[model samples]
Target: MKKLTTGLASASLAALALGAITPGVAAASPAPSPSPTADAGRSAGPAAPIVSRIEKHGADRIALLGVAPWAEQVRMQFDGGGSVEPVTDGRYTFLIDKTHLGKTATLTSFAGGIEGESIDVALTLDEDAAPGIIPVMPRVLGVSKDSQGVFVIEGTVTYDPLQFDQLEVTASTGGMPIRSVPDVNGTFTLTIPAEFAGRQIGVQAHLGNKSSAVDTIDLLETRPNTASDTHPLAILSPWAGAELAEPAVTFSGVAIPNSQIVVTNDAETDQRFATLCETNVLANGKWTCDSPRLPDGEYSATVTEKPTWSSVTEQTEGSSFSIVHGDWKPAAPALPHLSSITDSGDHLIVRVVIPGASRASLEVGEHRDEQQGINGRFSFWVEKSLAGQTATVAGLVDQSVGKALDIPLTPIADTITPAPLTAPVIHHVADEGGHVYLEGTTGYAPFEFFTPGVIAKKDGKLIGSTELTYNGAFILRLDEEYVGDEIELFSTRNLELSTATELVVAETEKNSAPETFPLEVTSPADGATVPATSPTFTGEGIPGAKVRVEDTTAADKAPVLVCGADVLADGTWSCEAEKPLAHGEHTTTVTEAPFWVSAGTPTTTRGFTIGDADSDDEAPIVVTTPADGSTFLAGSDVTFTGTATPGADIALHLGYGLAPVIGTADAEGDWSVSRWLGNAPYTATVIQSKNGKQLSGAHTGPTITPAS
Candidate 1:
């Protein structure tokens, strides 16, 4: 504006630089007037309260210590009010939320006004509270220190815990505290607490908060510091001793330098044995352990660990041994040894001698051989069948002190035998028509053909014998019952006898007979009494003949004539009489065979009546009742009666007097002749066929039977 006043003072310095570039121009700041160095860092005495110490720096940061550094804008709050924006430097890293695990967090930090730090951090996100504490050790796989100074700790206790309590178990050369309890699958059983029995301990374990790091186990009872005229630990042999079959037994001793020789067997009750080889007594006190095969006897060898303070003077007073084993001894009753034996082909050799004995035990019957080898001599062999035998040789003189002696052998009978057959022979001939030819001679074995007695039509057919092979031969087939036969040839091991002189047979030719005719009863055509049933015996032969019906008064009876030959197609031989003929007067005989010109006289004969067994005396009134063999099927129903004869006329007959007389018997004589009697065997003869025939008498009416 020194230009308008310089252009209006440059527009009033561009309006105070557009009012300090507008925007409330610092709210027109007239209030900072009482500043005094920012009011001495503002504080209400207690507002100097940031006082922080928010430690917890692992698992996503926290460390906010403050005595003044302005606590770097802290303000963390979380526990679902979820704030955590802190971290300007006082170290606050808050992303929390692992579901805010057991949360509770605070951390405030007001700036210039001085209220700097406030802290209450907790959120640990449970990482199992830093777990991983598994240490409970006591591993002694197998320990042995026995001489009575006692050392037996067999162990295993890895990582144990289940409310675990007492277990300090220490042992470097010193150990004790074996109380245990872990059996529900956790497994722990400790036992070493006999007040630490004989020291050397150094094993450690102590659980609960855990502490286990030392493992040295060696309570070696004794056997190391030797001096003062040593040699007093003798068990010259017997950790395990027995010499029956010999192969194991070596327990030598003279210990002092760490003495331990224990070889027990006062019948061992758990003196726990197994220590096959330990020897360290060398200052000239010798020691050895070589026992494994033991089996026959008594033993006791003791020196059981001694040397801790030393005190065991040349001890050796427990020996009661015996292992006499070389069984099978019994041969001094004067020498004739070998009592029995046998083996034919594959090797069976025997030779025996046992005077004193080096070794000998051989029994064959029930097989026995105690390391057989008697220097005087002995041999044995037997595979399967000891033909007929016996063997016994028992001689054992020193099998570590046990003596034996016996001898006996005898086996005989095998002289090579089996052979017989000299010039065996047989021959027979007829060759052409009826075929009869046999020839033989064999040293080969195997031939047969025999027959004896019962050869009718040609006199006793005898071939008697011929096992052959030392001479074999065969052939003979004369049909027609061996046509005029005559056979006899023998040779089965020298029974020599043969003969078959030109036999011949051939003659057969004759066949022309089968045509006869004469069996005629045409229908009911012969003494007809047509209805008690079954009647059809027509005739004419040879179309397959065989027709029979003979009741010539019953007894060995003969019924079969159910017809065939095409009934009437002309070669006519009809049949049908299976049953219906009892009322007396039935002489129906129709036999046929091979043809039949009456087949020998009776191809037919019919009389049929079967209705007269009823002459009434009160029980015989079965009128014309038909069924003991009634096969009449044509229109069925045929019942007729006749028993009311106290006065006489009870006439009823369907066909007995032959065909047609249906009913008549009223005063309770009961008459029923229901018609339809068409098919065959009918003879309803309650006769009196009518007044003048006279022989037809018995008609006592009403009796229609058959329901029971």
Candidate 2:
């Protein structure tokens, strides 16, 4: 009987163990049995005091707390949206959206277990003086290909519900701007217009009068593949509209299990003959196949699922694909050499000598066009705006780079409208037999002057005369044998009599060549500061002679050729640097090497500096609006606010490869930036800049967690 009693007690204790406390929650003590007098009224029980509390979190968020048992079936109604959940510690937590400050909130608790009265609580939210909406700028994450053949732009918008009514994203492809509204998450994904293909596009986000910085992307050189809706098998790798970096690529997709998968570029032909990959589908219905190294071209693939047992054969339509050699390296070739540069008053004439080139083109400032040349020789006419600028001439054969040349322009006088000449002057005179070849300068502009005439006489007696072209150039044939006398050459333009230029022939030497001088720089006056990266380097050199320019700034550094050129017939040469030079002092040496033997070295040392036009290099200061380390919903928007130097611009970079959003600070140095991030642990950074230069370091904010 004693053992039976003990067994009964053991079983009773086992039954009591079922009411144990849950993890992370405090165990509640059982209420003592009511006294006999207190339970006198059998149908009635004493009332328990209502327990409730309220906590303010931020300008827009509030927390409501209460006892767990009583909080069950409790409802709190306020503004915007709110949620309630029970915590393990016998407490109920309610996240209330306090959109209207100073407004009363009602919390009603239902009767507990049908024995208690329903309780109602009222409370007013604390007043907030801060501005309702932050002025943070919007930003873009980046650009990518959507399922469609077009591009999709993604970004975020952080704004105040009380201030702005809407946020819009816009895209421009040289036509009417396309606009879109961000979803509830403050994130937007917009599809570009079909007409945007082969065009440079610009995207931006707008909120009323405020606009985000324009983000530009180039799609002019690429062709994205559009997916076919009929294909049952979806190609996973080398996704449609994907720009690949390699030619040899692998394709992956999903199809029916145990069925044969055949990938081919040709839809009309049997895939088995020109199959890129042919294999039995895996148990999981996934398959992957690699193709041979493909040349840079467009490709398509289709799959055929062969039947087994009672299964029927199925074939998928062709899918779009392309092979672009974005990383292909080409063989290096010799560069085209600049031969000469001449200043022709209003325009600069540059000549280049390219070798082994079948075609060539000249690029002068914003103008680029193909030009014809005989024997690899090309000449380009540069406008006045190109003064002190670099001109490039590219030689091509089979659409491949054969050679390239760069020349500089430095005119002696300002660009002026040609004025009629007061008089024509005779300059060069050469006598062959009784004929005299002459070249001269004229004040008359092109296409304005008539043909010129020249008369020759010895001792005031008419000997011979000839008429010449209107270009102020002539050759007088004096057939008379007026030996041992001073012969005068008189030039007349349109019957306007001009003074005679005397020419005496005394013992003319046969087979005599004109003298030539070495290379020398004349314009830009030595030690003058020029405001250009490719400043024109001008000087005198032997006519039609080649010269090489080498920058010898530092002895320890290797010599860099800034430019190369040929001397013009007028003994002047100009060449622009092949590339811009860095800031600091530079000493360039120009050497004349017409025949690559016994060349002349006449070097010039000049000091110049290049300044950045965009930035001041000052670091910007950034602050997070929600004060970092905050938590939010998975698709909720997160706003960040910070301070920087007044008039500085701020940008917020969200994690997960998203494009950055940009905002400008007001005069008070206050700024706010916002973005809706994905559900994950994210640490963001704020960048500040004045103009285009960075003013501050990457001011990073605390990490934030977004829950589902």
Candidate 3:
């Protein structure tokens, strides 16, 4: 940004000085340096050429250059290309292929064959109509005026239209330019007053940090578009190419008000058809719906919008999104707008457009109300007298709070008497993993919440708070110390919300009931014979407990672990046997041991026979490939080969919770299925009927770990 001593240009600076080109070097002083550092003892040579403007002509650049001695016959030479004699005004044109963009090019002026200093300029196509910068002018397609004296100018963008922020239209003679956002579909429309009619209007497109050349069009009046307040269905949230960590998604977008919007994803066709929600568009012209859970992969949702009084429906494909494990979904910024205000007698119902927000807050004066799990449209109720006041709106989505927006509220109408408050009632209660979970509903306003709202108080001491959502559902978790203590639950700190409800903690922390079946086998019921010795074992037990089923058939035989699984939060567990058990009568014992305890409780002894060894059976089913302890690399095909009874259909489950890959045994009693494996570990299980079913199915080894 150094400034050169202002010296007169060689009458060539008008064409040599560049302006407003993007990704540009800061504009240096147009005059040549007057420093006497070079050739001090003799006549200093001619100064290097200065580039003032660069015009794009197809793939070539017309550089308006400046030289020190305009009258001298100077040969202008460009680096990596041949030179051309510059006109008396110093205009140098050269072919700059697409490859030359962003590359540095040198220019030197030769005065009487003595080369002067050389200057370098970075080649760039980014141009603006502003002085010193060139451009690719926009094209104006049509112009018209409506009956209301509004002038409309429409145009077609030849380049990437979706990336352009705005297009400016102005009367070329004299007037302020009107700016309008260009549609992503390569078209734009701008409206101005009748003052600019019959004038040649210029159009310029502006992108981030760059602008296009000014293109002009004769603004002759024509027929105006007759459409009312209407817009195409557009999906604004979960924008193009978005990736999400969670499976469930909430699709939202803008459409014409009252337009019926049906949204469907490209997953589970049957469910997609049956679960489509109609008329998702709210009164604010924003539509949204909670989507069903999707599996990990790339997916797309399409919206079909059907307007009232129209039999035709238009469908638009939304952007693709990926459901990836552990990937974070950043919250989109919400522009909360005051959608509507209704007089509901007792209160003023104010609905705001808080798109993509889970929690919304409406603040007027000093009072504020917040709603959690907000959907497409969130409404806030306030006193009728508070209408016409400005309110600040905010939303929280994806754990990100959006910028607060202030919007003016409309005047409210009539009002009525307020209802009396009632105590909140608890409906369901349970104890799991030492914590009390309670679901309840309150008779007070659902949107109201305080710092210690819905509190659990022990002996008048503030303890905990829970929120009652818009659906009238509230859950509270208490510590083990409150298992038997009597606690009072109140709706708000002011005591105006609801009366206190007194209750005692029914159960917590322990599930040591001896009469209940603490541990039992759910699958392969106790006495029923199983076709496969390596069968999957699943059962329910107390939360936080670990269950292990071990074979103790022999009096002095070492116990063999048939299956082991930790109880889930919901008291369910399942695991498979990596090693096949020998086919014979076997007695097993179930042990339930909570993680916090040292000893495991022994349940009833269970006996089950495998394969009915006494009956003459067919060929034994055995897994041949994926030997025990075999390792696989990512993307490798994991092929499972096993022997099954001839002519029998086989179903093989490669890992837990996975659907079985079905195959048939060949005439020679061989069956195999191959699937691509990711970087993970898996233990397999194969199943068949017990009639002609062999009793063993496994790799007969340890679990296979795929290399990371």
Candidate 4:
């Protein structure tokens, strides 16, 4: 599959308020301290209501934008019986049935009643008189060095994806554009020749009429130790040029089974090329590392081992292979952003937006037809003689493959019956006492009734299955001994079945839970406002239990499964989001999965706002215990204290924009922060804000000289 992993950063916005002012520093105003309020720890209040909208994209799908910071506690039901699924970044999408063209969707807030905030939104849409094109662009995530010292590029193509069917990666050094590698799901990975290393390369995607903005990445220089002579490692199977059908395969060979092996792409130039695989060699002297999901491409896998008997590492020549999926590698875009398939009895209807394709075909089993692509849209129907057949829509711009959709067909009894083909939404899965309980909502469609089911499996063996109620709500309880098993929640629409969502019942027999399930967040101080987008989340949980930190800001908010570390023996854990959260009040919840303990785990929640979007005019006051111009040794803990608006976040910046320490003020409007200092002449200041606005002036902090 094509791997579009590239990304681009937006320019930063300027802050408004100045906290404390100090002489001899330019623009040295810091933010004031933060204070907790009555609404502290609350996820949603009357401050902001959820936003909802319904609009048609191209001609096939409807874009449902109901995601808001306040959407987590909201329950939704549509007037026409159609269902929606949450996508990335708090957004959702659903197929637009012609029967439900003029329908409405109602959202009722406070579904969880956790914050007592109530509101409602009714979204209605009319057929578009003037359809607009949805823009798509390619993003280059990064470039890595492979075992053979080549660079591999990865990134994604995003947007409603009206067009841009071709992908290319070229270096500033100028060579023919590397065009069209096999891609899957809009992401592509290409191996760069060794000569392109250490140069700035422009990665772009192309459509018949337009191209995406060029994303650039500087390839790292190749290291001299490309081949290590001392390491003992060899790939045992799948020799060079071997062909594999699966996206992922296991690479095993002889090595110090108990030692560490770094396996990587032989010619990719990214830091991740060298992946450490720890091992237990089988009795036959085979060690293994499962390769990551790879797109269609030629790749060489290399392995290096650190033997237990020697400190020196041994490297072996890599094994090369090819992964071939389908024949068509079209530069045409995938179906527009919200393309979908509907099962209609003996036939399945497919609709998608494929820009610039004059000819398109809907292929199901042995049936194929020349379909038209109009206004970046393609809609057609194919005979569904066999249920569960894979549906493919191949669109061609000038007879070349440009866009394609591979949708799975669900079985339906007849055209008159409606089915909830959308997948069920899993709400929560936890261990209550010694039983595992799974709860969620089933798929729904107008005039269609859904029967949800829960399936339990271990090691690919079906352990159990049960049907659920007609209310679209399901509760499945399992024995505690099945803690490590995998559970799937599914719903059946008409004769068509929705895709299942799998959740693992964590194994926690060794690291027993504490009596009260200790999980508490220390930073952002429960409703404290800070300027940073990705603030650090620090807390304590059961020492051995796996803690899942979820951005519970909205019901549609996809949880961040593992943002940080495993719980330390001391029970403390710290993690931060790889990307920044939305710029508003966000509710974050930490829950311990069913690990070591048999009892249900209590969840801990906190709320905080990301400030610094809008500027505040008020100046803040910052006061540190150590007076300005004082001297101290390196590695000494220093305490910084200040005052600000009762709830403003105080950011203590040492030097200029370096070593920032944040603290929230107490009810008394006083705040204290502490951190260790390395050897340097430190000038202190603070930046204060709430909801991205400065609440006070920047406060100038004391300066201390750190002695070596």
TM-score of each: 0.13, 0.22, 0.28, 0.26
Over 1-708, each residue of candidate 2 has an lDDT whose tens digit, in order, gives 000000000001011111111110100111112212111112221122123345587767676555423224444555554343432323455666665445544443333322222233444442332222222334444455655666665554433211212456777766688787754324455678555666776767666565767767665324222111111355556667655534656676654434467777774385356777776543223456666666776777665665321212365746667766543322221256554454533445554544324346777667775654432344455555678877677776443464465656653221111222233233344453333443333222211101223555566544444322212222233322454457775543311334666766443432111123444564333444433355545565543345566777788975666765544322344555656777655677666643211232344465444434343434358574665777766544577787887877676765322335668888888998775444346677876655334554678876777643
- Model 3 alpha-carbon miss at residue 658, Å: 4.5
TM-score of 1: 0.13
> In candidate 1, what are the lDDT values of residues 1-708, reduced to their tens digit?
000000000001111111111111110011111111111222311111122223355665544333212233445666476553443432234444355556666555455333332435565432332232334455544444546544555443432111213334544432234444332112232345444655656556665566667667555533332232323454544323433223355556544433445554456566465443444332223445555555655544444544322233333335344454333122121121231233323434343333223345556677665433211223344433543455555544433211233323445421111122223222222333222223322221110101110111133222212111111112122223344555432222111112322333333222122222344444444564444445444445422234445556553653323322221112233344544545556665655443211123235565555443233244234454544344544434555544543322333443211223424445555555564432223434454221111122444433232221
Q: What is the C-alpha lDDT of each candidate?
A: 0.34, 0.45, 0.50, 0.46
* Cα lDDT tens digits for candidate 4, 74-133: 344666474424323323444455455555554433313432222233344634322222
Q: Write the residue-wise lDDT of candidate 3 on 1-708 in tens digits.
A: 111110100111111111111111111111222222111111333444544445576545444333333224434334555455543433344554554556666665544554443455666553753332222355454566667978777553432211112233333446556776533223456776777677777778665455777776667676332112234567765778877655677676666444567776656478736443454343223456667656688877777776542222454655588877543333332455444455534355565544346567778999887754222235565666787788888876545566577756674321111123445455455664444655444432111111112556677544444422222224455545687788887654211335678988785344333223256565555665665457666665543345667778987966666655444322345556546877777788777654322123646577777755223455666888878888886545678887877765566665423334556788888888875554446677776543333434432333687653
Residue 623's lDDT within candidate 2 is 77
Please give the TM-score that candidate 4 achieves against the real structure.
0.26
What is residue 124's positional error in candidate 2, in angstroms?
Answer: 38
Residue 241 of model 2 has an lDDT of 61
User: Residue 279 in model 2: shift from native, Å?
Assistant: 3.6
Model 1: ten consecutive residues of lowest lDDT: 1-10
- Say which prediction, candidate 3 or candidate 4, comes out ahead on TM-score: 3
